[model samples]
Target chain A: MSFEKQKTDYMPVELVIGQHRGLLHYIIRPIVGDENLVDDCFSAVTEIIVKNYDKYDSSRGTLAAWLTKVARNGALSFVQNKKYAMTAGDRQDAARMEEVADRKTPEDHLIQKENLAELKEALKSLDKLEAEILLRKYYYMQETRQIGAELGLSERAVEGRLYRIKKKMMKKMGGAIHD
Target chain B: MTDFNEIKLEELLKETLPETSLAENLGVINPLGAAVNRVIAGMVMTTITLNFLGLNYILPTVGIMLIYLGMRTLRSGNLYFRLGWLTALGKLMLTTLNLVLQVTPYVSLMDGWGLWAGQAVHILFLLFLGLGIQKAGLDAGMTNPKMPTWPVILWQAVLIVLALTGINSWAVLIFMIWAWVRMVKHIYHCAADLKQAGYVVPVSTVWFSAKPLLLAYLAILLCVMTGASLLVHYTPLDAEKLVLAEAIGVKEETAEIRSELISKGFPESVLDRILDEDLADLGSVTDVDVLQSGDNTSNTERMEGYSVSVLTEDGRVKTFVWFEYVDGKHAGLVDSVKIQYDEDQVTTDIKGRLLYEKKGETWSADVKFEEKSRTYLWFGDITEDVWSISKYSFPFMADSPRGYFTWWTEEKDGSPAYWSFNNTVFNCLRTPLVLPYVELPENADRLILFGGFGSSWGQDKFQIYATAQFQ
Candidate 1:
């Protein structure tokens, strides 16, 4: 198809999110503390995809992966910026985050921030297959069986990928994450 | 109430992002862009390896291509800035040395040095690459360089272990491919960081264009190495000449040879008599036949067919010279000498006197008697009393055969000399050479000429005897 034709035929945010919601859930699940606010991240994730729809390029990655990344980035931005965040279990998570922050040196905190930025850069360096797999596993939060179906792999293969992404995360953390 | 609220919120996102056919309209991520660069890197590295074996002819050409590749790698941030240049330089140095060794007459020496330098440069390339990687990390805004520590150290260790244990080249190739992949991964990250920092990177494309040039360079290198080896196959003898000269304890030049001989326990008058003879003429030898057998196996090996003999006037110093070859090329001369001193007894005894000495006064006879002496010695009645083999076999076996003899004597330490041939207790007498430095007994009454004479292929032995009468 022509470039213009492809660009005009953009996939809507809802359908992309519908397919990859499970992936997005799992990526934010570790930091997500609120029962009521779990789905709140989804709205922000969807709105970010819709707002940045023109920037989404298929030559870079798949629609599902792009949506998942947008979702992941938006939710992370919310967690960091504390925007639209209300008290379901958000207060308890904030308390936990603060408690953890108090133990680490400010220098370590800065290092972590720097590492987080590099991790985003490392994401671009990943091969399309690895990037896609990471997106489906951590961002979409799908079960191994469902991700296996989407990627045309066995459940065990998808499980193996879960371990690999964990390693990738650790690498992005510059070996700071022990477990 | 929170769970009910979350369910309500989930209903909203699902309604918003429902599955649509628009997913099919999106452009696909092309794997080949990154893949093309990988192919170029692999081809360039293989080219580097082939040329690094010292193929000098096409090395500069390949080096240029590698520099281009290196520059591209640098532009893409796939290579650390300075290391790309160093790798190219190291490879060129190794390849040039390999080529020089092939064409030069100094093959043995250069080859030894090249081996050491090749391995040393290879390790240095790795070091440079590591430093380059560190630089790339610093540029990428890393607080501390997260150079994939385990992979780099562990993989190089694996390569070393494989090399030390004599692993096959295939295992090395496999490891290289793995290393290349991992290296590309690291470079991709660096490149990505650079791209984000507003750099316009040039990556390798046009894959098929480079394949033939690299392959052609390899083919040319192979042909040159083969041709050069054949052209210089005999060059190793240059080194071997020094070895031969050292063993013989003499210089190869005629004047130096004479001096070295006289200096090293040899009498000057003996050398004077033989130095002007045809025996001193030098000839390049292609083969050797061990005409006489003795305990000098090592000396026999160095015998390159050119043979010389000298006898001292006192019938004591005997020297034989032979030529030697190294790496199928003509080398130098080696000398073997036998010296006898008069005592109560010599090395061999016969009947009741020393085996080969004039017992009293000399019995004079015309020398150079090649015809009658040979006729009577082999076929005529001279063997009537001596043990003679019944000649009934081949024509060449028993016939009018010829041999020569010489006898020289002085008052034990005379200057002038003659040549004769005499084996030890083993019945030599094969090639006639002078036995030098013999002192006659005070009451000696007889003479024995060439005591070690025996018929070839038969045990028929004879010794021409002359009575030496002292008034």
Candidate 2:
């Protein structure tokens, strides 16, 4: 109860967290795949940042800018940890499985897969969040706050995630089959 | 930026991450007590250290308050975050041990392995603690952005060890102040963190101004240390003469010297005989006096002769003084004593800040001797055209170089004895000439001069301020 410097309206971190919820979702969703996995990544990131909140130095960058870096790195660390967890033998098997799945594609499925892969690669050319939002809103259907919660996201995060999906989908629509 | 947008976490990692089921945001909870914990814990540690070994200071109320605070923090889940509290506890424990050992007889730093072990542990504790703190946040200098790497911890530990040795007390103080400042920054940020998490936290009384307050404490400590150095560094002192004068007391000034000289097997009533015999050129005077400092007769009956003084680097001075048996005066041990005088004050520049010791500030030395006793004295108490009584650290009564039964008082076991040479204690290396106490004389020039040939394990060299002119 004795920690305040002064009283203010609204939870302070929520203001910042609210502003960047979309970006955070964009960074996290793909890496984690499932909603529960997304929550795990999000929780660890927010905890690391919040616990070390006092260490934020504005000289390095603005708070908004710093948060972006932290979110990116936190997700990276989570994914990297998972990546390194598997033994070399397990990783080879996994890679082999992916190759086998690629070879088993239907003749028409191959064309479609190539089309989607090209689209995905083209989407990477633009800002990722806007692209992901574009793709999800147009293609994935209504992404309600309930879905946001299920993905361990604020309502704002779901909106941003859709924006990135759409933005990336647009790049694919334009490039179509540039490769 | 060029990475595929569709690339998923599952695809990148060959294995699935061990996921946590935690959904609630525990980080948002208000850290109301951490602010309180820092303030109260700091106050407790400061009070205990300043009060010294006096049992009265460790009031039951304070102890109870600390325990209560610890419990409160532990309950609130901040005990892990606030490990700094442990460091204060360590200082408290070590200081208490020093007090206890002082009262116990036959227990010394050399003999007390338990105490030495404790001191070692405290040093290690502080080192590891600093490393931990570094990990939890950014350094004050802003050079570090995250937790301390292993190399960072190693270097921090090394610096602390040097600081404990008195080789870097000032350096330690500087770094510590910087750390406190940085920690204060972290505290304020943490408060905002809680607020951001939707918690209404109250204003902290001490945490807001903790940085400036820490700096202020350091400033006051520096002021006290500076005053002490000026007293010892400015004056030109003859260590040999000062040691002899202090060892013998103002007996030579009064009729006490005559009585003491006769009682200890000196030439027949020199005080009366010298008055009637001396004209000039008093050469190589020698006498053996019954040492009062010794606990036993074997230690009591000791003899002494001339001692010499030499100027060391800067304005510092040292003495080569020794003591022998009253019967076997030649076979006695040599005591290496060092000193300072007020006649040679020098302005010191600390961290680019111009500082000067005042004139007429008496220079004194306080060698934290062994646990049993300590030898200390101030020079330059000129009275009635002659020097009055000056306390000499050489506890032996002008008898042996290896002083008989001198008071040996040590704060930490296995700590070096250089700081307590004559009357002053240097806070750091670079031969601090900080402050306080008078200077003792060397040779017959009626001058108090201090000059030395660095410390050595060589045979004890002795110096005399002036010949014993019993007038």
Best by DockQ: 2
Model 2 misplaced stretches (Cα beyond 4 Å): A1-63, A66-179, B1-77, B92-471
The residue-level lDDT of candidate 1 at A84 comes to 28
Cα RMSD of all models vs. native, in order, equals: 26.0, 23.4
Interface RMSD of 1: 19.2
Q: What is the C-alpha local distance difference test score of each model?
A: 0.38, 0.35
Q: Candidate 1, which segments miss by more than 4 Å at Cα?
A: A1-179, B1-72, B75-79, B99-113, B131-145, B149-209, B233-471
List, residue by residue over B1-471, the lDDT tens digit for candidate 1. Answer: 234433432332222212321222222212122322432343344433342223333444455444434433343344553455455566555665556454444545555567657555555554554455455445433335544333544555666676679777887788688786785566555433322221122233222323344566567755665455333321111111112123232434555546645554334533443322222332222111122222232222212221223333233323232212222321111111122212211212110000010222211111111111112454553431211111100111112111122222222334332322222111122211111111111111112122212222222122222211111
Q: Summarize candidate 2's per-residue lDDT along B1-471 as a digit string, tens digits.
A: 134533432121111111110101112112233443443353334323333233233442244234223322322222333344454455445544443333222225434565455455444443443343343222111224233223323444555566567675687678766765554455444333322321121121221123343445446544544444433333222232222233322333435434544553553422232321111112222333221213221111223432222122222222222233234212111122322222222211100000111232212222222211223444855322211112222221223222211212122343322222222111111123211122222211111112122122211223323211111
lDDT of 1 at B345: 16
User: Candidate 1 deviates by what RMSD?
Assistant: 26.0
